[model samples]
Each structure stands twice: as C-alpha cells, then as structure tokens.
Target: MELLEANGSCSNGSLLTLSCLSHRVVCQVIGNADPVWDNGTSGNSWVTLLETSYGFYIGLGLAIFSSFLIGSSVILKKKGLLRLVEKGGTRAGDGGHGYLKDWLWWAGLLTMGGGEAANFAAYAFAPATIVTPLGALSVLISAILSSYLLGERLNMLGKLGCMLSLVGSTVMVIHAPEDEEVTTLDEMSSKLKEPGFLAYAAILLALCFLLIFYFAPRYGQSNILVYLTICSVIGAFSVSSVKGLGIAIKGFFAGQPVLQHPLTWILVVTLVASITTQINYLNKSLDIFNTSLVFPIYYVLFTTIVITTSIILFKEWVSMTVVDIIGTVCGFLTIILGVFLLHAFKDMDVSLGNLPQVLQSGQQAPVTRDDKNILIEVDNSSIAPEDKPKALA
Candidate 1:
C-alpha cells in the first residue's frame, strides 16, 4: 500500500490504480475510460468494467419494486371508479369528486404515492437510463394484474407481449449505465447550469408555450397528440429535475447542508413546475383520449424524451460500449413492440386455443366454412364492443 493516506490523488489527474494484496483495482478514471477494459486474460472477451457498487443494485431493486406497486395501484384505482359507479355517484371520468370519498381510491392513491417515493429514491442511487426503462415493467404488471384481478381479457398476443417486455427489460437492465455524473448537490448544480442543459430547457419551454397557447386552443381537442406531446415534452424536463432533486435529497440525508445552496432550491422549483405541468397535460389527454391509446403513446414518447435528455444532461451514453448500446436499443424496441401488442389488442379474442386451427388451415390448403368463420371472427374482433366490463371487484 502506498503510504500517501493524506493525498489519494493520482499524478495523471484522472486515474488512480491501487495495489492491494491480491490485485490492482483501478479506483478512478476520467470520462469513458473505465467502462470497458481489455484485461489481456483471453482473446475475444470484452468485460464491462463496472465499479459494481451496492448503491446501484439498491436503486435497481427499488425501481423494480416501485413498478409492481404502481401497477397494482392502477387496478385499485379502477376498482374504486367502478365501485363509485355501482353506488350511483358521479364518476371521475365526468369530472366528479366522488372518487375522492372512496376508500379504494385513497388506497390506490397512497399505493401510487409509495411507488413514486420509491422511484424518487431510486434516482438517487441509479442512473436515469437504468431507472427509466424499467417503467415498462409497470406496464407489464398492470396488464397481467388487470387480466387476473379485473377480469380483463389478455389474449395470446398480450401474453406474448408481456414475455417480450420481460426479456427486453432484462437486457436493458443488464446493459444499463452504471456511472453517475454528479455525486453531490454542488456538483449537480453545476451540471444543471451547463450550457447544453440550459439550451434544452429553454427550447423545451418555448415549445410547450406554443403548444399550450396556440396549438392547444386551436386543435388540441381534435388531435389528442397535441396534449400528449405536451405531457411527453414536459416529462423529459421533469425526469431531469427529479435526478437533480434526488441528489439534493440524498446529500441532505447524509447531513450535508444542501438547503443553503441555490441549486437545491432551483432543482426543487424546476421539479415542481415540470411535474405539475406533466400531470396536468397528461390528465387532459387521458380525459379526451382512450386510455389504451394514451398509455402506449405517452410511455413511448416520455421514455424516449427522458432518455435523450439523460444523454445530454448526465452524459450516461459517454461510457457505453457499441455492443451495449446496440443491446439497449434492441431491448427497448422489444419492450415497445410488447407494449403495442398488449394495449393494441386488449379487446381481441385471439388466443392459444386457436393456434392449432390456424396451423391446420395453413397446412391443409383447403378453405372450409370453419376457416371462413374463423376469418370473419378475426375481422370482427377489431371493432371494440360496448359492454359492461367483467369486474373481479
């Protein structure tokens, strides 16, 4: 061991390789220097050199657990709404405050709040990319739960979609970014004020202003995307602010005097404004558009924008390998495809039970009346039926 306990600084101003008893641990390196390393142990083997801290795993676990809670909360909320309908009270869909009085709704809200709190804590420990894509898990959870809990039909495609989301999520989590650009509130403040982020924030705000004042007043009702777009755009800003505020919170809990810093207040104000805007516009979109349409679109846009913003703000992509990057993209695409299948075919009656018939028809090369009936049923399944939902409530 080097006897320089007073100063652990490296002479190169970046790297500090420590010689322990068994091996040398590279403690620090600048930028993307540490993400990948050729250890010269074997040919054609590239190892991802993560510091492998426990904090990252903690964040990942919290993010995953939050997804389950959030997913369950959706079922609870929907149940509350259904119960209100049974009681002959005003429904929330019609701007009624009756759901506020329902215990089930409050339970759902509290569950969601707990999930959000877990997610908030997750941001402090994990990279935004790692935490963000994991939201897909919540969608999968909701689909599965709704199928079982709410008596919603999940066709074979939906089941396949859930599986795809799982596989993709696993790939994404495995290849997710591990490094944090900012560790302390002071460092986070500097990152927030960086010119790149400031420009992004300015341009985003301008776009929101035009969309809200001009486009929304004129065409928002006609085109639901306008409102959803606003929600997605604002979501990017909200996520970044969440990261900053997370750092402030983490520092504060560690007995650091983060409250005195202007950046702490700045992050708080930005978080509140952005989160409020996102929720308001999102609620508007939900009220106007069918939830089946809103969910996939909002999730896709919100996640994509947050990812882009994270790249610019935290520079997480700076440490990514080409293979890891490709894996992440493929994983995200898989998740999107899964989400599309799950929501897009929610009302369809397609199932594994019909697979054999389809295969037999394909192999026999005979267009029988049974086959024609199957084709007709397939065509008719596309139209949504107006029927009371089978609630497990």
Candidate 2:
C-alpha cells in the first residue's frame, strides 16, 4: 500500500479505468496474490493427501502383500539351494540345474510366481508410479528375513547400507526425471517402431547375447554382475514388452482383436524371451551373492537402466528442474555408496559395535620413550625369578 501510494500516478494506459480498478480489489492481486494458509503462510494447502480412489488402496494392498510373499520366497529358495548342495547335487552358482528337482525350490518358485502375479495385478488399479516404488519393500523384507532365517549376517554396517539404499531409492523414485507420454496402444506401437528404440533393441540384444554366452560362462560363478547385468539389461526390455502386452491384452478384451496384430505377437514373444532370461540370471545372482546385498544392488541397477532406457526409447525422462536434478544425482551417489559398502566389506565382520573396541585397543597400547624402560619390563616379564632380579640389578 505504501509503495502504491508513492507511485500514485497510475491508470493512464492500462486495461482498467479508475472506476473499475477499485483500491481494495487491486490490492488483493498486488501483494497477497495467493490465499494464505491458517498459519498465515502462502503455500500449497490440502485437506487430505490420502483422498485417493479405492482402487489405489486396493493396488497398494496387493503390492505390500506381494512384497512379503516374494521376500519369504527368496529365503525359501535359498534354503532349497543349500539343501541341494548338501544332497551332493550341483549348486546353482556353479551353473547346476539340480534345483529343479527340489520340491522346496519348486514351492518357492510357485510362491514367487503368485507374488509376481499379485504385483502385476496391482498395476491394473493403480499407476505404474505407485506400484513401482513399492518394489523396495521386497528388498527390505528380504533383508530382515535373511538375517534371522538364512543367518546371512547383516551387521550394523550392512543395516546402514540397506537404509542408505532404501533412502536413495525413495529419493530417486520421488524425483525421477520424467515427463508423460505413451498412454495408448498406437503411441506405444509408434515408440516401438521408432529407429532409436529399434537401435536400442539391437544393441541390447547383442550385448545380452555376448554377456550370457561368453561372459556368463566364464565369470558367472565368481562375480555377481555377470549374471545380474544380463538380468538388469533385459529388465528394460521386459518392462517395455510388459507394457505393450498389457495394452494389447486390454484391446483384446475390448473386442478390438489386437491379438490378431503381428505387433501383438511380437510383444508376446519379446515379453516371454525377456522374462525367461531375467528369471534365469536373477536366480543365479541370488544363489551366488548374499540375498540382502543382491536385492538392493539389483533394485538400484534396474532402476538406473530403466530410467536410462526410458529416456532413450520412450523419451519419457526429461525436464527435471535444477533441484530435482541435484536430488537425483545425490540419490544416485547414495545408492552407489550403499552398493559399494555392501560389496566391499561383505566378508569382514565389521559392525558399528566394533568401533568402540577398536578405539579402546588403540588407546590401550602401552607407549615407552626409553629403550631401557621397555627392556626392563620385557626382562621382568620374560625372565625367571633369579634372572629377573639380576636383570633389574
């Protein structure tokens, strides 16, 4: 008001005449343009953030339920693998197929299949955004169960690593650089037919072929990445295929007969291929690496590749603000650091509780400036009774 009064000469060439632009009305738009909250602060206010549709609730429930099942399945499968080893059968890490005959392993597979089905059903009621992030729950549940069930010791450091991974993943999901597109079958078909995506498909196939045939045969047992890379790289293609297949299925149900289209068959083929490869490698990774370690690393790497592939193929990732970009980079760093911690000292028995003992041991080491003092103490401790007195003298 003071500034307006100081500039008093106004209405000459504006849209409003003096009579129309009332002092009180104009002042509302001038300073306090937005409605203030009850606390007298200007910001986005909401009555309730939880006012979502019932379908969303259903989807959320399904996702959480699936997580528990999947998490438990991981342990069950691991136990089955251990049993297979004890029975003098070849272990999975060593490229053995003995797990197929194990009833316990079959049970785990069935349970995991059910969990995956539930997860897929979730996407029916809710968007991919909500369903995707809840995936970390499986990792958490698996980590918790592994400590007790499998006795894969997730000490204080491992716990911290898990926390970091979860936190980072949450940040990454929240601020993932993406814009929206590809809602319909036509748009998806177009995306699939694009030269860029075709190129991506070709390169991906080549890389995966090499990794699976050449690299996996050599390093599959020794390293986690060999198997996991094949899994992770195929993950993007799997996602794309799943989406395309879902669209085609929806069209089929609507009487559009999309299933008759060659594109639909292509999608079906791609989905089956990608899923087969993913499952095989994923199993090998779980068998070889610590379950807790594998979960977070796999989640992180899969998310990274999915995002990258999204950017390249679907052109979905774009237009992040400066703040969002920074958040994303920080989150990426946190995940990398978490994975590093999980890998680096996985064999070491170090935990946060070990810190005090280390510090105390460092503090307790006796120091002597004089060589004579050290020699006397040493002589007294080492020499016999008569020699001790003689050495002291």
Candidate 3:
C-alpha cells in the first residue's frame, strides 16, 4: 500500500486492481512473516528451537526410553520366561540345554547392547533417513540363522520372495535422497568411526529378531522359543550395525572412552536391556504359537515401525518417486504374505517332539472329507439285514 501510494501505481498493468489498498493490511502481513526467534517472544517457543538443535539426541532418547519401558513391562509380566529354556532343553533331551539357552540369551543381549551403542551414535551424527534403511539387513541375517541354528526349512517360493524383497529394498536405499551437507575425513577421527556397513547390518538383524519373537505367536501359531532366539540375535546385529554406521559416517573412533560418550552409553545400555527382555518374551510366546504364523505378523509390525519412523521422523520419502515407494511397499507386503503362507502350512497338530509319529505312520491322517467317506462305507457294508436298497427290496 505504501509503495503504491508513493508511485501512484494502480490499475495500470495489474491482473486486478485493489479496490482500496490499506497500510494496515500490509503491516499485518509483514508482522506475520517475522521469525519466531527474532520476535523476542518467550515461553513454549524455545521448545521448538531446542528440538531442532538436538533432534538426533531426541530420537535416540525416545528410542531408549521406549525400549526400557517396553522391556521392563515384558519381564515383569511373564515371570515364567526361564521355563522356556528348561522346556527346550527337555525337548532336546540334553541336560545342558538350559545352560546353552541361557548363554545364548546372554550373548544375544550383549550383541544387542553393542548394536544400540552404534545406533544411538549414528542417530546423533546422521538423520534417521540414512540410519533406518540399514534395517533391511535383518531379514537376511534372520533367515541364515534360522536355517543354520534352528534348522528351519525355507521352500523355493519363500527363498524367491526373500530375494525379491532384498532387490526392492536395495533399489529404495540406492535411490534415497541425500542431504546436501557433506562431512570431511578429518571430522570423523574417533574410534566409533569403524565398521559402518557391517555394524548397521547387524543392528537391523537384531531388531528384526526382537520383533519376530514378540509378535509371531499371536498370529503364526508357531514355536515361540525358536522365533525368540532368532529375533534376539537379529536385534543384536541391528544395534551393532547402527553403531558401526555412525562411526563410518563421522569417520572417527572415540576409542578407550566409549562408556564416557553419552550417546554410546545410552545406546549400549538400552540395547542390552531390550534384547534380554525380547528373548524372555519370545521364549514365552513360542509356547503359545507356531513359528510360521507368528513371524509374518512380526514382519508386518516391524515394517510399520521402520516406515513410520522413516517418514515422520526423518522425511526419508519426501523426495522419493511414487514408483520406488510403491515397489518397496509392495515388496514388503509380498514378504509378509509369503511368511504367512509358510506358517499356515506348518503342521500344528504335531509338536516338534512328535515328528517320528507323523513320519512312521506312513498314511495321511483323516480329514473332514475322509470322515464322510468312512461313514458311507460303514452304512453300505452294514446293510442292516432288512433295510437294503429299494431296488434290492
């Protein structure tokens, strides 16, 4: 309005003439454009600035707090968690089974601690956009561990589906948008700077295991201990991977003073606690469900967690093309469905202990259709001595 009045410029070359330009309106618009920090206002406004300055800290803080709360709740609720180890040992007919299971759980927890340290460090140094995508490694690690340690069999279709999902995830990661800011070699001179990709992959694997153990039983109806053990290892690897990624990005190794680093301490402590809780909870859940049914649900839940974290927290997908997003989501969905199918076909009637019975019988068990045939045969053979067919009568 002031400019217009000074220049005496009005309906000369404009799309529409302002009926009456007012100085007050211009002042109001200008006032609204002022930055919050510059406005000199006090109160809750500082919260936003604080969050922005320490956004990475906030993310790791939330992750640790949430893990603690959840882990503690699980341990407190299921007091019979150790029973799972005993049970597994009894099933295996090895007196040392309990000791072995317990040691495995401990090792898993240690690995998880390492992974968490890496994860928090990574989060502190880089955006979650870069960190969370590394979680895709979990599936690969879990699959390998399940096959080798647990003797879980994967059919051709399941193997194919895993490969496809991996390809899709790789494409998504490769095409992901990168931040314009660059970090030079000298900045990352700390001990935490080593083992980037390997550490991140380990963290993803551990987290995946944790998720699978927690959710597989309610839906999959498979063995919970097997799933839990697998999940624990995966979770351990994921946390480790996260820490390694941080080191790699920053290119520094803060050796000798690892525990002194706040982020490192937070990651390690939270990760260990979380993995222990996960193993305990998973062991309990396996007693309640079959593994195949349980694992698929876990996968869906994990995908949701990662994708949600990626979008809302890091805005990883803002620059992604629609095709890439669709392909990634579809691939995840396909893997989930494939896991469900695997669980559904797993024989629920026969426990792991009863495998010999199923094999030695050498005949298929009677289904609903078989019952109908048996009834018909009995009726035909009996012939009630006087109630024969009408034609015979």
Best by TM-score: 1
Q: Which stretches of candidate 3 lie over 4 Å from their true place?
A: 1-94, 98-251, 254-261, 346-393
Residue-level lDDT tens digits of model 2 in 1-393: 322444554443322223344443233123224544432212332211221225456656776787777777767776777687689876454457787788887787677777777776654444444355456556556667878987777656667766886787668656754333554467777887889889988898898899988999999999877887887788877766655665565445444557567887787788778777776677666546554366556666666676567667656445567787678668767766665565445455666667688567764322223234322321222111111110000
Q: TM-score for all predictions?
A: 0.77, 0.60, 0.39
Model 2 regions lying over 4 Å from their true place: 1-65, 76-110, 122-136, 148-153, 176-180, 212-227, 250-256, 280-300, 319-322, 339-347, 359-393
User: If both were scored by lDDT, which would come out higher, candidate 1 or candidate 2?
Assistant: 1
Instruction: State, as a TM-score between 0 and 1, how close model 3 is to the true structure.
Output: 0.39
**Candidate 3 displacement at residue 301 in angstroms:** 0.7
What is the model-wide C-alpha lDDT for candidate 3? 0.41
Of candidate 1, the 10-residue stretch with the lowest lDDT total is 384-393
Name the better of 1 and 3 by lDDT: 1
> Of the pair 1 and 2, which is ahead by TM-score?
1
For candidate 3, the per-residue lDDT at 325 reads 69
List model 3 lDDT by residue over 75-151, tens digit each.
Answer: 22121223443464332222222323454444444444444444455454444443443333344444434555545
Each candidate's clash count: 0, 0, 45
